[model samples]
Target chain A: MELSARNSLAGTVKAVKLGEVMAEVIIQVGENEIVAVITRSSAERLKLSVGDRVFAVVKATEVMVAK
Target chain B: MELSARNSLAGTVKAVKLGEVMAEVIIQVGENEIVAVITRSSAERLKLSVGDRVFAVVKATEVMVAK
Candidate 1:
């Protein structure tokens, strides 16, 4: 995924579950885990799997940085 | 949230689960559903719920339009 927001976190694909037309892709970024649900058709094309490198893109305007 | 890619899909919040510091927000966009994870602080401030309108922003470099 091409995100304009500056994201710099990488993780390994921990699991993937195919849904109707989308697939839930889970990745472990450091100590945190995040999920990305993409179309099943896309999953098949990407051939994603566990142990594969993936990214968790996050963009929030209200990123309140607590001091 | 700010995204450079153009995305135009709206949905109603379905569920939310608070994690260590993030909250899993689920939204039903028509027949499809997507998840967005934001800091717990954001969720609380937003006051997200099962009836609020939200947008799902998706940007795939390989957004292949199969003919």
Candidate 2:
């Protein structure tokens, strides 16, 4: 079963910063970007690698795409 | 200004389905849900009302959250 916090971004893993037990991920969606804070375990599970094409799904009550 | 699938989801507005102009949003981050397809004038310029609680962003690569 998936948790409530489950949304996704399909793009290139432009960058990755592992910190403590959480990692800061930056996914490039076209010319825009999506930022996600994930746990080390999840990061490893995704086997996320720089330049890798992956989705960063996040379930948060705070999505605001604006102009 | 922002545009690029953007990427966001603060929750509520549990459901919305317009058409053509591309509007079919379902934002419920706490209970697993964040699907976006906007254009119908931003579902009324985010003035969207359906237990309104704005935030539904997406930039467009693909985000993946697993079990």
Candidate 3:
């Protein structure tokens, strides 16, 4: 399906850190890896594991950078 | 508007670092901040400036965590 987010990077699951309420999902995209903190229930629903192929989609109204 | 993404974070623009091709945008979410790297054109289109409120959306097939 089409996404409104402008940034969509194809990546592989590198690691998963589950917490009580939040979970940290790490995706390796090329030389860099992006991390996403999500709900623990969401983690369980997806049943994410290592070596999973996933796309990281980020939608932001404004993307700011440090000068 | 409603989004399919499970993670939606409310943040404020802290800084913007523009580069030749890509730009890194930093948003302060409470005490924690999230960073997003997007194309320069996308950054310019949004005209992101400091203190702008934004919502960070992340969509992934699976949200994993380490056991």
TM-score top scorer: 3
The C-alpha stretches of model 3 lying farther than 4 A from their native spots are: B1-4, B7-67
Every candidate's DockQ is 0.04, 0.18, 0.09
Candidate 3 - CAPRI tier? incorrect
Query: What digit string (tens of lDDT, one per residue) describes model 3 on residues A8-63?
Result: 77899899899997889999999999997777777777787789888776755445
Q: Highest lDDT: which candidate?
A: 3
lDDT of 3 at B18: 94
TM-score of structure candidate 2: 0.49
Q: Ten consecutive residues with minimal summed lDDT in candidate 2 chain A?
A: A58-67
Error of 3 at A44 (Å): 1.4
What lDDT tens digits, residue by residue, belong to model 1 across residues B1-67? 2222335478888998998777898889999988777767767777777898877666554256878
- lDDT of predicted model 1: 0.71
Deviation from native of the Cα of residue B20 in model 1, angstroms? 31
Model 2 misplacement above 4 A: A1-7, A59-67, B1-46, B49-67
